[model samples]
Target: MSTQARPGWMEKPRPVTQVGKAIALVVVVALVCVPFLTILSTSLASQGEVVENGGWVLWPTEPTLDAYRDILNGGIVTHALGVSIGVTAVGTTLSLLCTVFLAYALARPNVYGSKPVLLLVLFTFLFPPGMIPSFLVVKELGLLDSYASLVLPVLVNVFNLVVLRGFFQGIPEELYEAARLDGAGDLRILWTIVLPLSKAALAVVGLFYAVAYWNSWFYASLYMESDHWPLQQVLRTYVVAGEGLTDTTTGEGTVSAPQTVQMAVLVIATVPILIVYPFLQKYFTKGVLTGAIKS
Candidate 1:
């Protein structure tokens, strides 16, 4: 076929179409970046600058780290930060381990009860237990008012489990047979063959668990005492509830304007995820697409 005789859809984009795409890309970037910039600028802005700008400083005339200093100076925010870190670290590790183990088991061929267990897992995903039922279960387990409550209730996410299971099942059965002939058991096969091949899925699932643990607040409010609240819940109190930081909340903090304090807290909460995302960005598309659709 002649090049000029090709269908219109096969041709390069027209100039107008290219221009429209470029404009759309810029608009999307602005929509994502502008809010973050505003937040960072407002957080760094001087009290006078923030006040003059009517609670928003898109470009601080004189940037200062006073808000961060106040938050980190032996404050409630600092403690909450510690709690969030500990919870996220411990929760992600445990959740990932449990998910990986369960997924591998379910993915194995002709495993006893694997089909029923998988069906049960999917059923839970489709019809999750309600808040009240979950609360009662937690209470029965005597996990309320404990950090374990946060981790135990959501240790294995169904979507992550399903993704991992799908990925594991996609591994070559020839590899399994070879491992077995070499005297490798399930654990050995999982460690030496399956895991090394499945790093992409693991990375994505780990990020999901980490983010979930880090950002969770509703469960904290339900199960934990105020003194044990995580950073997200504490930030909710300061920003959504419009509360001032007390002496106990932030030792030596002389309540800056709500905007500055809230923005600073937001930055602290967000920076960790931003820092970690780049490390795993390369794995996201591979993991999600392959895991979700490979089978």
Candidate 2:
């Protein structure tokens, strides 16, 4: 038997009717590229050129890696880079686990007091516990001057929990029924089935948590001793606050190049996020749409 052909309208992709979308895409891409190009150029440019043409460098006439070397020679920037990496790794793992458990519980129908728990979580978003109260709690827990202060208080994100819970709820009931018939318990189902299926969601949410922790400085500034501060905080002190300790660590009388070193620090702080983002981008739309549709 021969099948009949479908209508022409059903065979074509949606047309890009408006010029506005094309222009917007161009503008958005250009805006993103310009800052990165500026940072890269500034980082590569020689100290003489940087100073002679103000603090900003559009393009390097002669590139050098002296800035990277000076910073790596046991300076403030190098120490702070290690601190940032450590905190980000620890924080992301803890945050992902906590969010997953809370979200999974809430996703189940008739979970005991799940509504109230969700409300409490959402309420915090609108009316956060005052900073003073939070600080006191951290102090009472004896987390002061400790790295725990960076990770623990912000361990679970309400938004991430909601996203995961919605995605969990969207899983077809037939899958759960099939797993149950095969003698799988809730934990077993989650581990063997749900989690594997939800990899995209997890990857996207995990990346968000990782990026937040990596970029965080406010909490570190408040809770950490200045000596143990993360890269962003140290960057603020040296690059923004103009308090240099490069020579102090280098055993030299003066810094090799202040502007180049500052740009190098900025580049270092930004590079990790840039590296992580492309890997996670594919998951974002898939995960976000599923969560959004359900929630």
Candidate 3:
């Protein structure tokens, strides 16, 4: 075979192809940006403006942060924010610890019962517990109505564990042999060797855990009281039941249309993910690809 590139691959596209590609890109951008703009504008606009403009605004005539202030002024919405932050932080940390320990153990060679344990883990991944059984288990464990209900049942995500295990297995055996020669035990080897090299995978898995915990509301609904509901569950009520929140901006305490308050809540719930994702984006591809290739 000639060591030349294919002519078609190197050739510039015709004008028609270029135009079509540009059009497609523009359409995709508009589809995403338009809805985001409408929600943001609606949230910033006054309740009267939102109501008068049919629940969505492309641009607010006069933007105000009243809706945001209302939510952050130490009410249920504020409390829910606290609950969500706490749960995401604590849950992600615990999940990462448990997953790292388990994945490291499974990745090692000739460990007692490793195969059966790995098989059992994969079996759960394939056959997975149903909602009813999971609920019953949570209830029986006296986990209902507590924060543990949110974290414990879903901790150590099977996919994340498998990904970490695969990533760990890809480490060269020579490194392990060297660590053993230095009289470093498994814990020391893992701490000083495996973990430092697996930063990308750890970052990816931690991001996964954070996002999952932050976005979870179903479990909160099932196991928590209304007052204990996280931001998503509380926002769900606003979006689903069409309930209105009081406009704290006005001294008269007027009730705002659900759209502004609802959109504000949605934006708040969404912002943390937006902020955190960029930091981890650079690691995402390598981490996922390494695990996938190993598998």
Model 1 alpha-carbon drift over 4 Å, by segment: 1-12, 248-257
> Model 2 reaches what TM-score against the true structure?
0.87
Better of 1 and 2 by TM-score: 1
lDDT of 1 by residue, 1-295 (tens): 2346668778765888878888999999999999999999999998778888798989998889998987788778898999999999999999999999999999997678888998898899779889899999999999999999999999999889988999998899999999899999999999989999999999999999999999999999999998898999988987877776674534444454367878999999999999999999999998898767843
Per-model C-alpha lDDT, please? 0.89, 0.84, 0.88
* Tens-digit lDDT track of model 3 for 156-209: 998899899999999999999999999999999999999999999999999999
How would you encode candidate 2's per-residue C-alpha lDDT over 93-194 as one tens digit per residue?
Answer: 999998998898888775788889988888988898999999999999999999999999999987788789888887898998999999998889889988
Better of 2 and 3 by lDDT: 3
Q: List the candidates ranked by lDDT, beginning with the highest.
A: 1, 3, 2
lDDT: the better of candidates 1 and 2: 1
Return the number of clashes found in candidate 1: 1
lDDT of 1 at 58: 90
Better by lDDT, candidate 3 or 1:
1
Q: Which residue window of length 10 is worst by lDDT in model 2? A: 10-19
**What lDDT is reached at residue 260 by model 3?**
79
| Model 2 spans with C-alpha error above 4 angstroms | 1-25, 110-113, 246-257
